[model samples]
Target: MTSSTSSSSAPEPIWAVLGASGFIGSSLQAVLARAGITVRFVKAPRLSARSTDPAGILAEAAELHDIRQDLAGDLAGADVVINAAGLATPAGADSPELRGANALLPVVVADAADAAGARRFLHLSSAAVQGHRPVLDESTDVEPFSAYSRSKALGEAALGARKAGACPVTCLRATSVQGAARQTTASLVRIASTPLASVAGRGDSPSAVSSVDALCAFVLAAGRYPGEVPAVILQPWEGATVASVLLAAGGRKPLRLPGWLCRAGLKAGYALSGLLGERLHGTLRRVEMMWFGQRQEPGWAEATANVPEPRVEQVLRAARQQR
Candidate 1:
């Protein structure tokens, strides 16, 4: 989605979204378009799809040089550049290639944004970078264990190193994301659809999910936020736990497994997968995130008044609405 209807009081901001075909980017584009904003789809060659470009503005590139050369016009014209591109477990987390893409691409995008004279750069980071913090905040030192978490932490650090550049930067560290095509939402739907579902593990840890709408809203607000805003921002509100979210989504209470047993299985499975190079039901990263509760400060300065407290019901409703 690239230009917007500017009023006398507020001018619309042009946005260049890297990874425009991904879940977050596509959702953000939809939100921006609804608000009459213009969006530029800065896409990677491997993942670029013509169908994803409703705006018909496609800038395709693969490498760092390719990004700069191909999206030069989009970047130069944009007021906000959002680096929503990254590889995760859902995409492909098996190799060094995905890790490198997640870790290094944000830095490249930030450099391009700086050179292009963009006003603000927002990179979508993850809360897992905080490791096993009981309460996550902006001040928490990153303690990443897994490769995915390390890459995200490194990406944030990369952006921080370039804060003095032409464009001001911020990293929006989202909790687990739910709503629409998101894996979490899909899991919920699957559980709900099943008459009797085997929900593994004791779901005591908080999910700290941000509904796609709420997340998109927060991202939009952060992009347009004043210069006084901090470099890192957490999702607003303390989010729901996995159990509560699942129940709220109308899934029956899962047949519970003992917490200790669950932990043992998770550790054993993760270790086996790593040692044998075998595909497992879930990655170590996913299991760790699920077991380690994500609790954050109540109010996020990055959130606007209009950004609703994300709810599990909202995700269920959004799923139904989309269908």
Candidate 2:
């Protein structure tokens, strides 16, 4: 569906969403539009199809240059600003761009928002920040493991460093987010379509996932009800294993591969695919490692139960339609 604004009695607040072209950002755009709020998307470099989808809208509004650049004009009368950009490169990977995007950019965004006189600034974060903490919450000590986790933690720190009450910042650490056409979930679907779908091992990890619609709902609610809801964790109802999600997406039962065996298989698959000039190996292997490496926590499950359920059938039906 195309993005639109809902009609409200009083003039809706002008909202600026950074990274509006990303998976969660795009969804937030649609949610805000439906709330009757007129959105002024601020992206890195404006694109032609800014309002195409949630992500497209954000991409179209990006500043293009460093975020530290003046946004006083851009954010002139914005009532709220939401930063929902992140990166998830594998460990030991060389990713200067990823670091800048995930770690550094948030600081710049915060600075800009402060200068713009925005009353509320919401920072979208990852649940990975909880790291191996058995039980995570706002009070739990943060212990990030992977580069992605570290980046998110750093972003949160930056948000915190900002003088308190200076545009009350709310940090939301979200679990694995799922939706109809997100790259992450699409990759999971692609891996499920392979012959080696049965390679997943020991799928007892209690991981949480959030649907795209639910994520958007949270973002809009945050924008609409800032301070009223300071910060919270968000996850899907009934945490599922990688294997279960694959099965739900129509893949056969995954083969359980031991750690050593899975590593060997990945190496072999990469070598063979390189020789055959085909992309056979699954990219989700990295994700699987992240999921398995970290200790499971129940924070997301506890928090998400309070939030409303998303239209899962609608999302699934949309995926089917695309197929």
For this target, which candidate reaches the highest TM-score against the unseen true structure?
1
The candidate maximizing lDDT is 1
For model 1, the stretches where C-alpha displacement exceeds 4 angstroms are 1-11, 45-70, 90-96, 192-205, 277-292, 302-307, 317-323
Worst 10 residues of 1 by lDDT: 51-60
TM-score, per-candidate, Cα-based: 0.77, 0.70
Summarize candidate 1's per-residue lDDT along 63-133 as a digit string, tens digits: 34765655555588888898888876632334545444555566667667888998888888988778667
Clashes of each: 5, 21
- Write down the RMSD of candidate 2 (Cα, Å): 7.9
Poorly placed runs, candidate 2 (over 4 Å): 1-9, 45-69, 86-96, 132-136, 198-205, 226-228, 231-243, 255-306, 310-323
- 1-323, model 2: which lDDT tens digit per residue? 12246556787788888777778888878778877888887764222221212233234225444435555567668898877765554343324455456555665566677777888777788776766565556643588655556656755665565455466667777666668877666655665567655533576554354477876776666566523554545443444555555455544566666767656766676677556533332243344442342334444334433454555434533453454
**lDDT: worst 10-residue window of model 2:** 45-54
Q: Candidate 1: lDDT of 29?
A: 88
Candidate 2, backbone clash total: 21
